[model samples]
Target chain A: MPLMTSLHSEASSMEFPALQAVSTEVERATVDRARAGDQQALADIYDWYMPRVYRYAVARVGNTHEAEDLTEEVFLKLLSAICDFKWRDVPFSSWVFRIAHNCIVTHYRRTAQRGGPTSEIPLDMIDGRHDIAYAIEEQITMEEVRVAAAQLPEAQREVIALRFAVGLSIAETAKALGKREGNVKALQHKAVAKLQKMLIPVDGK
Target chain B: MTEFEQRLSECLEALVQGRLSVDECLEMHPQHADALRPHLIAATAFARTADQQPSAEWATTARQRFLIASGKSLQEAMDIEPEPTFFASARVRFLLAAQKLRQERSTAKPRRVPLFGTPMRAVGALAASVALFVGFSGYTVQSADAALPGDWRYPIKLQTERVRLAVALSADQKRDVQFDIAEERLQEIEALAYKGKIIGPGVLNRFVEQTQPLVEQANDGNLDAGDAARLQQVSIRGTQVLDQVEPQVAAGAETELAQAKVISDTGVTVTRELVVKNPDRPNIVITPQIPVSTATPEPTEAIPTDEPGAETPTPEPTDVPATEDPEATPTEITPGEVPTDSVVMSELPIVEIDDIKLHTLTAGRLTLRAPGPSTGWYLDGVPESGVPLLVTMKTQNQQSFIVLNTQNGDMYWYVSAASNNRFDEIQMRLTRDGQVFQADAAVLRYFYGDAAEIPLLVMNSIRILPEASPTPEPTATLESEPTPPL
Candidate 1:
């Protein structure tokens, strides 16, 4: 039985690389160090996570320059805020993205108060992929939808953005927004009704 | 909501997702036309906006301007707004005045050139001399083949002058040579920046402009060395700008290395001082963690005492009881010790080794589990598999053992040399405080040699007495009764 077990171990060992286990150990140690408020560890996390955040911000903000500024500002805020963050129920990725979402919403709110319509979506910063032309075309329609959405009550716009742009589920959206799931659903329905009335031309011309 | 509104909302969702059928879009009635019209127009406006790519340059420029305008009043910043009208008003007066001046210039045109030409040519000659100096410097470094750190700056200077001269030069035979020289200098500057020796914003900006075409060309992926050199130039230029402004950008590395060296050198000195200063922080109240035993009974707590001369105050364990084992038992009682009280332990089972796999972990905690009658396990004297056990490791003589336990997974054995009765348990097992561990295979292999195999049932028995004597006995007989703590 021992010989059979040894043989089985040998076979399975050949299939799994020992280095994979080592990497996981290293990653866990690094994450733990980061959680302990090691500045270097936090910086490393920033270095790895920045490019993705920058790209996402650029896609949303529609200007490379603003996105770059926003990325730096977001990271700066994250550095100060993360120390006090008690990650109770959400995944770390979700927490980071929530920070990003808050930053974007705050920026829009600030800009809106300054009297410019917060509608110019920065499509130019997106990577020029093969289907970029099609993506742009679709993006224009989405922007229009967003504009029509802007005409809806603020409650509806929040629900739609949370649902579509952030890809949060109804329950997750509710949790994030601190609203009931039913309220979110009703707002979503009302928002959609208003959007259709705004979008579909009554004259059909 | 009306039926039309519901249908329209569904269609809009589909539309936003790029899944709307043409038929579905056409199905909207005239009453909903106001909303549908804008959507259609906005959707079709894509063709016009397709080529309008967003660039960061404008935003960066705006931000820089905003920074500069920081102290200015709102009215002062708005000063540029009314400038268009100001210019319009000035234009009327200037046009009438310029007509009179033109008539005067026509009369004085021939005489003015001699005055203008001498000074203008002198300035142009001075610029040409500076350009030649820059060109010569660049060529001298390039021919030597040893890279000059400041060579890129010379080409940038030469290129700037070349641009000026190219604009100033008349249609002459030397015009093409001027253009070629300008282009060559631009390329050379790009190459210098690409190599990372050259630094600065003015020089870097020149390199960025030179490499712009190559960057566009490299979008096709079959970029030649020249194109790669150009892209490298732009990236290096970006880094150079960053380096100049923010020297702390690479804060982790150089500072960390310096601090680490300091810490290593002052290791014992710093430690001794910290201990002398805030002695309270290091003072640990370590209750000798009770080992899990096979004879399941009504759980009792044990108040552990401090070992030897450790500075930590050993708080009396709350509500512990005397050992109830009938076999070997603890002989000495530290008199006057507070009697430990009993409290029903709450099952706040913390997930030990969460966000991680316990068995494979080397740096984080490793969870050990005992082979069970059912599958639930225990840690300490408690029955809770999910309790998050604090993971810690000890390294001695170049070998490292990661020791930790959540409820079900507990390591309770020792290495062969640590045991006193070696003959009783032939293969040394890991110990939790002092008990035979029947944790998983990974724990067994990690604690003992790879050849070690633990018995399924008897392995979970306590080994309270140190294994000093090699008592020759069958494992079944040795593990029949719980060994009391000596």
Candidate 2:
């Protein structure tokens, strides 16, 4: 019951507008300059993509510290490989997120080898802008969702993180994950269904 | 997909794009209202939580590091050579042409036969050769014009200049070509240095090698007035450019830079003497203006040892232990308020273990102080020299680790409250002798916001002891055990 009440309150307060991709012409010119080793142009690319990349990283790893480390690694790899990037049907955002995906996969692999905890959303990581009561409620709701999503299959988790958390379109998510569009849709549906079942009972007991 | 599933997907997309609210989505799909409501709420909450922006301090530091990496990557990419096949094919073509010409000349008799047998044929051959030359030569020369030392077209540029020199009928013309080539090398050095690329020794060596002869020629009074003026201009410009670029040159090229500077200075001296000898010559002005530099000044190599707004107080060594007095209290300082005047040690009771004190441990030039035995902190490993001295302490509720740079007195510490407390290994590996572990230091300041004062105070208490004479190793002698050992 508390979960339902908190969810209703959060729904009224938060907005879920779609995140727009940057203009193609400006991005293409910037990428061209970046490939030529222009520092300002490379900085521009980092400024535009760093946040979205961080969001996807945090959504996947569920830890701020790990997410920050992953973001740094992703950009370092980008610096080394940007010269070889060729424009194709895939957008630069897709290419960048692909790098993030690979980094997260590698991170998880290393953690598993060390037998460490896979995902943990710390309760103390709540933003301090809101009133105490509201912040606590929001933190609880957010933690529940993160915990539920982490229990989903890895592929399904990646689909929702890219599509919902990062605001990537289904097509872009497909390209980032190197999957078919139809497959991405299917995964998204199953993931949402599982999350709904876990967070809210279907029989309304 | 089932109809219900298809309807659910549509509602989710609509909600995400803000085209419909959750209630509106429920209204549109009345049958799937119960299923869609929770899903929409969960998706929104996930996005809200995941959309975390990095702290402003972290972002600023990360951006600086990223730019530095970009400079290094650009240097590396430019250093890579082109494919070997291109060079091999070019070499084969040159060799085959030379061999064919030699064979034709050796086998020819002294007959009066036209080379192409007819005027029309000769004209056609001439046109074909000209067409071939114009097709590739124009672009190659244009592209090679701006080629830097490590660039693939650099060889072509050098070869073209050599050909120009070979065709010059007069020594003055050849000398003029040499001056142009030397000036071009100077331009290349300035351009590469401005871009923050590593200027290899070969580049500076080439500049010195080419310009030294010109400087000697002018000094020996073997030049005309025009050539002397040109040499003066080139030498003056070289000195100005080299001085501007000295800071931007990457590490490990200092010897070559010094050699180049020496040649430029000699040229300037010789050229000035020539000018003094002939003051009546018109337009032989010695004061050439230095070009305005457009490069961003590189970051300085000095590491800031003192905190901002804090007085640089030299800590005095004390003979009394920190816990000797009952009223000795630990003072609380805030982050960036690192005490530099005196040793602020913890008042906890020091425990002596095995004739060695556990609270204070000395290694090389650094002396570290931990809280006490009750704090459940202990040294993790034997401290070593020539590397970062890692003192790791893990308690039940919190974990803290400090790395001391044995070379410098810089200290990097981290404290984490999470159960899985782990320091960044990559950052730890970046701790070299002379360089500051800037990223880790920034992280420490960010994470330890209010509570940074105590750890910093304890860390700042690490005194940089003076160097002492090495003690001679005691000789070891084998003692034979009794017959029981046999």
Candidate 3:
């Protein structure tokens, strides 16, 4: 219910890169074709937001497979919902992510009902690419980021994950979370202030 | 937002995108520089975490599933709109997934499903072929390449790949070709993961073994950008991949995990060694990587590991350890031998991952071999087909076979689980983790080759005793044949 507060938030000082994101002329045409049952156009939409959707889902869900399943459910749900979606001032990207965020939240609730989700980072399928080994550093950083993120208060975590993990513009994140742009900014600043302690290099070396 | 705060937000966004330097950021807002620096640092790190790419397998599946479910309702996972939404302009009804469309119609009534953009007849023909695949096994091979694993032709598909390798001209050509094939293997794993199909450890093991040497080889030469980019993509992606794969390995593979680390640790040294001497070798192109040291620091040893994940400020490696021969064979040396070379320059701790091979098999394969004991060997009951599987297992007594169907990107879970015999320690280990075997271990070795060519594969036993030899070809002769049917 909190996420569905869908009326557009008032404008604020921070400019939303709304044009650069969801409402581009090409995107509008693609939406048009998608509504007309052009599968390719719908596929294009999947291509554009999949990585972002996945990043958000994975960070939120903490498992690739679960994240993937949730993402698929979100898209499938979108198929029925898309026709009814009249573009407000909000970006289409935000609407989809809102759906995805709800999907993940519902998943956690259901899994939690069954017992808490597995605490162990399910090390089930190993992917040891040579270059991926070099990315070991990035992976370690991400894991730490993941843990640190999980530790944040709910609102702060939402802002951080939406803005950073999903690569959303400030306004898009605000739209997706159903919050004012200024409120999103304030939450982001607080979240960063907290993470700074966690991420700072010791001894300043 | 005040003008200062507005500029501050822009600077922070730029910092997160890695476009603005911390000093330049501070310069823009001299008054708020100190207050904002720490937040900028946090934002930058979050940005880095966001930069991680989802596994290619996940990406491919997301697109296909969307295509497959074009106008479907999530409830029944169908596209047959009992009630269609009205469109203001000309509406074009694209054809649907036949399966979903079929389900939508009342089961009591049978009717022909019409095609829209693409012809329905062609798809119908393909469906008929798939149906035929189940009826006759051999008919599947010709169309096997397009088959996904679990399809009837998957075994022939695996055999087809083996046949291709058998005819390769030279060892160098074979290795190069194998590297290319390994990428295909990775794509396959991604494809399987995309479909939510079961990917066993064996399949991933094959790819891991294939790529280990390739990863090692990459460090010896100055990497071109394309190659470096490829390697980086694999390495970064491997993190999430490890999350998917590690639970499947039987415990004995702990030893295998260490070997993979040697390659990564060695890579770190070569990359560092080059950078340390960059003033001399300026022309050799390099990936702009700030190597993150994953090594445990010791008081007496190299303490200046990159320390990327933990920000504990260990001093940079100022001393270089004596060089151990980089060429020393991985297994020949003491297992998990920490590289001592950082003492020679700077004290960089040797950060080695325990087993990258075991991990990569999430996207690779498992190979089985036995040189001693029962020279006539079998995996999952099928007679061993390929030559000692070109892996560096400690001994021939224990082997892991990760059979993958070449036509399809699916893993042969049967082959992998077969190695999990009652006596097998690996099985015990897998059981210790939460992996439960879904199908029978007997399925592991049942070969589905040409009915004439398919050996009466011995079931469940890894070793084929001489008395029970199904096919009496020498190991050399077997080298020329394809992997026992996928």
Candidate 4:
């Protein structure tokens, strides 16, 4: 039988080109040295997590400018605390993700306080399938998916962003969201189920 | 978990990966096909959305920021230097303001005496015009600082504030400025709410849209410990503002009131997290901002008992948990809002959930029914699988196994490497730490690769709870009697 890792996550086959796992021996060595004050290694760590953090934050915030600012703040925070960051078995990406998650909640809270609109995923943020070969029905279907996802609870929305937007593993997602792996599974199931109900077109055309 | 549920989850995952046709999954799992079909389709559509990647220029800029900050910290540590005034953030602003003052003074031209017979009349007239100009400029600029939706000059205010942000030297300064501006917007929202304007939600929407990013920036790591307390103050101000909002703008509208309530509630939570990270004050309760007080309160209002702008000496880094700000402290909970312990939102939300899920994870057991002479059997733990188990049968055969992870309806397996009779029963795993997948049941089916025709299915519902793994007694997972490998 094929290895379970390959079949279980399909991380290698996912369409998101940027979801490269940082499990290489080189990454571990860099993290170790960065903790020890190696400047170049620290830069590498920033480069590695920046795209992931930005995509995840941007997806939740729904504004590019806001996401960029938040992403910058997250990196700077990482800069200040990198030396103090302890490396347990958890991947450093998960730690960065936790920061992103906190930032999103805090962002939402602040907006709510100011009496603001809740974030709905912005259409401009999603790339439309440009290949003319794809049909109109597919575009309509994709739009429905976005609207459906926008209505989910905060926890469920997070699961969708991490899984579809940033493409983290179940274990990594659990670490990032601070949920149990089983809990992530349950959330993933619930969110998809809701999206399914919402996205399906009424019986016939 | 029903078999259909498991298959549906697996098929959904596959559909998300673009690996399986939705029709195929629906056709194969007819029991839940209709229910699963739409979900799979949606998942497929969503998965096809291209993932975002930051522009390379952004990547370079962010990289440089990290390098600059990291390098500065390293140099400071190596030199054993006191805190360096690393950036001229304040001095630069002061210098710019001074230069503006000098330019204004030098540009002032002497006005010719007007046709009035008396010098006093001419002077008074000139003074009135000058005063009018100054007042207009001052009022306009000051209003820009507190501009909110519905104000005639709100756009001007937003544009001027944008100019201020463009000049900000550090993320911390930007965050502070953003918080200040957001506080103004909150005041405007509350004021409009008090007036019972039908336009209240629109204004509130603008306030939230603008302030949320700022709040995120404030909470993000750029702030010093002192600034964390400042952020808490911002949230408290928001809570007070929401109290105003509920009675007026959201009055008689249950949905609007509920939204206002959540906004205020979240503000308190953010405050608690910051307080826990940076406990600057001693024996102080994080009192909510009274509504009237929030109308014009400063965003950086220190603890109520303390002087404004007073910096609590940042404690030594050693005394602070690496997770928290060295300057902010958890203030005591007020007399009635919430017990201090309940407000301890803690570092992780999942920690609270984990405490409850383990009750369902009964202790899993492994039993060997049939014994063979000179056969060594062992079970081990691997890190890769969240619920990983390495099972080995050291008989003269190459063996692999598959486990049906009933919790999510996925199946996976691994082949143990050949080993001599070194370990009779090594530590095995029912589940991984930080990985609370369902704990109750799994069926391990063993296959003799190149040794047997049909696979041997050992179906046992594993009732495993989380184990301490401390005592030297028999492994918590081993059954009392060995079940045969029939």
TM-score of chain B of each: 0.17, 0.34, 0.24, 0.30
- State the C-alpha lDDT per candidate: 0.38, 0.63, 0.47, 0.48
Quickly count the clashes in candidate 3. 54
User: lDDT score, residue B118, model 2?
Assistant: 49
Q: Write the per-residue lDDT of candidate 4 for residues B8-107, one digit (tens) a residue.
A: 6778555544456667676778888666655665565455433455556666655544444444434332322322352223222222232332234334
Q: Work out the TM-score per prediction.
A: 0.26, 0.41, 0.38, 0.38
Better of 3 and 4 by lDDT: 4
* Candidate number that wins on TM-score, 1 or 2: 2
- Which digits, one per residue and each the tens of the lDDT, describe model 2 over residues B1-486? 988888878876776666777667777888876666777776776677787767677787566556544543343233333255533332222223323322343355345656756456435533543443231223444466688888876765665565445434468867987898899989999899888887876888888978999999998898777788788788878888889888866577788889889888888777765653453444311111222121111225223333344342223333433332211222321222232223333343343322222254444444555544455554455433333434454444455565555444445555443324343221222224333222332333333333343354444344444333233336432254435654
lDDT of 3 by residue, B2-52 (tens): 775676688767654446666677677888876666566566556544443
Model 3's interface RMSD: 11.7
**lDDT-superior candidate, 1 or 3:** 3
Q: List the residue pairs that clash in candidate 2.
A: none
lDDT of 1 at B337: 23
Residues B410-484 of candidate 1: C-alpha lDDT, one tens digit per residue: 333332223222211222234444353334443333223332332212233222211112334656675678777
By DockQ, the best candidate is 2
Q: A70-185, model 1: which lDDT tens digit per residue?
A: 66556555543443455565534445556766777887787779986444556654446638765665455545554565576766766655444433456656766667877876
Residue B287's lDDT within candidate 4 is 18
Worst 10 residues of 1 chain B by lDDT: B356-365
- For model 3 the local lDDT of residue B89 reads 10
Candidate 4: stretches off by over 4 Å: A1-18, A118-143, A202-205, B11-35, B48-50, B55-60, B73-486
Q: Which docking band does candidate 4 fall into?
A: incorrect
Could you tell me the TM-score of candidate 2? 0.41
